[model samples]
Target: MAYRGRFAPSPSGPLHAGSLVAALASWLDARAHGGAWLVRIEDVDRPRNVPGADEEILRQLAACGLVPDRPPTWQSQREALYQAALDRLVREGKAYPCACSRRDIALALFAQGRERTRHGELVYPGTCRAGLHGQEARAWRLRVPEGVVPWTDRRVGVHLQNVAEEVGDFVLKRADGLFAYQLAVVVDDADQGITHVVRGEDLVDNTPRQILLQRALGVPTPQYLHAPLVLGPNGEKLSKQNGAAAVEVAQPAAALAAAARVLGITVDPRVAVPELLAQAVRAWGARYP
Candidate 1:
């Protein structure tokens, strides 16, 4: 099969060092294997989206010389596809309505002393999994099977998850009327004919859920490689919410060098954008092991 990969970014903020690392990694992976590198704007969550973030991200990508092979796809415009996938899951009885509010679920988990979980999120208690009728279900969750789903992550080595224990039935559509990332990503990947998924290691845990959904929805499972994360100076995830993920507005070259360093490349600190990208891609492709 042809190799196809993508750099999917949510337009909640500008591209930070961590995000640039992910984008560069995905771009190198696709180009190294002679594959098509596509870009996808994951703007499904309208509430968190910042104004002008999408166009700004596009400009940043162009500035970095990572123009996509095709016009970028926006998840906001693909509601029909996500809805169809959700309906199929519902019809197959592989998904059900979930009425539990986030607060209620959190309190219940706390009451049960299930505060710590493998996925770091609540391992939903399957509260509405059985015999749940629409009663204004605020969300819909895909039912995870009882057995183990195993896949080898290209960068992270072997990975295994027992869905029922790790992530219980996961949300497909939020009660807030937006499709969850799992559902949207699977549908988009299948629709775009993507064959390889290169992303940050943080999403490694989500691969099983996505694979299960792909099978249930009759889509092909793509190969996955979860690259190492780029932590901030505090050794924590650099996120806009935390203010540690911000990019230096004055110098994108510095940001590119920082990203390259995070990816383990020895890059010249003052190279031009094109030269820097060429060096980074060649170094990454030849040395990524």
Candidate 2:
């Protein structure tokens, strides 16, 4: 497959240090393997997007000398592919309609003393799977097999999750027709022919759901690597909404070099972009540590 890899960033805001860490890791891994590095703006959830944020993200990457092999791809332009994947899941009985709402599911779980849903969304009871529809509209959920989500992670060790038991049936396409991240990511990865996925650790739990979707649609799954979460000075994760500042695109070499240091690499911040990339490639090869 020639080791094709992708850096998919959501356009919620400008690139933050956390985002830069993810991008740097994926870029180094792809380059070290002599693979193609690609970019995809995951603007599927349009509500959170900032106008012009996508362009700003690309500009920041360019400043960091992390140019993708091909022109950048956008998720908003790929509705048909997502639809096809959804249709296949339904036809194969791998997914079904769910009518549970946030409140209803929460109440169901409160009765059981469970504090949170496995995916952090309310744990869905099998309320809609039996052809029973509530008063509200229905969203589609994957009929996750009653077993563990078996897989391995490059960063996290020995990954497993029983989606049926832990996460419950997860939504595929929301009632408003916006595809779930699980569905969209699987479709896009297959569509782009991604052979390896090196991203942040926050997505490690979501990997199982994605793997299920991939198997249901008969898409070849990519190798997975989840990096550590970037924490704030308060010990919380850094996020755009949490006031994490944008990666200084005006000084991208500095941003890239800083991210490398944060990831425990001993490279100098003043290294040129090209040489920094080469050093990064060598560092990544020593161990994904």
Candidate 3:
């Protein structure tokens, strides 16, 4: 199959340095394999979206010469497709309605005297799996089977996770009736024919969840590459939630070079944006291709 990769960013905020690194790596990897690179705005979480952030992100990517191979896809506009997949999963008995709220889950765990998992995620105790009785469904969750999902990462080597044991049954749609990121991304990647996924290491844990969804939905799981993270001065992951500064587009060359350096690509400070990106592309092709 021809290689296809993407940079899917949530429009909750502008592209910060950390997100820019993921974008650059995705773009460079696509270029290295002589494949198509696409962009997708993950705006499904409408409540958190910053007005005009999507357009600003595109402008910044353009300024860095990391243009998409085609027009971008927006998750907010792809709800029908996600719903179709969820419906299929429901029909196949792979997913079921969930009525448990966060508080309900906490109380159940507390009553059982069970501590939260090391990952700090509240493992759903399958409260509504058998039946919801007369309660209305607040969300839908996929049933994870007991087995280890194993995949090798291009950057980090082999990895493994038992979806059922670790993730339990995960939600496919939220209580607000919004398609969950796990479901939306799986459907979108398969629809876009994304063959490789190059992203930040922060998402590495989510990979197994996505893989399980892909299998349950009968879609191919893409190859994975997780780039090193950019940390804040306090050694936390640089993210919008942490108030990381947005990448400065005023000095495109400098910003692009800084991002390139983070990915281990060096460009002459004197080089303009275009040339700097070209050099970085060549380096990336040699290193990653």
Please report, in order, the local distance difference test score of every candidate based on alpha carbons: 0.85, 0.85, 0.91
| lDDT (tens digit, per residue) of candidate 3 on 96-149 | 998889888889878888657737788887888898999999999999888899
Cα-based RMSD of candidate 1: 2.2
Best by lDDT: 3
- By TM-score rank, best first, the candidates go 3, 2, 1
Q: Find the candidate with the highest TM-score and give its number.
A: 3
Which pairs clash in model 2? none
Q: What is the alpha-carbon lDDT of model 3 when measured against the actual structure?
A: 0.91
In candidate 2, stretches whose alpha carbon ends up further than 4 angstroms from where it belongs are 111-116, 133-136
Candidate 2's clash total is 0
- Looking at candidate 1, the ten consecutive residues that score lowest on lDDT are 241-250
With a 3 Å backbone cut-off (N, CA, C), the pairs that clash in candidate 1 are 138-175
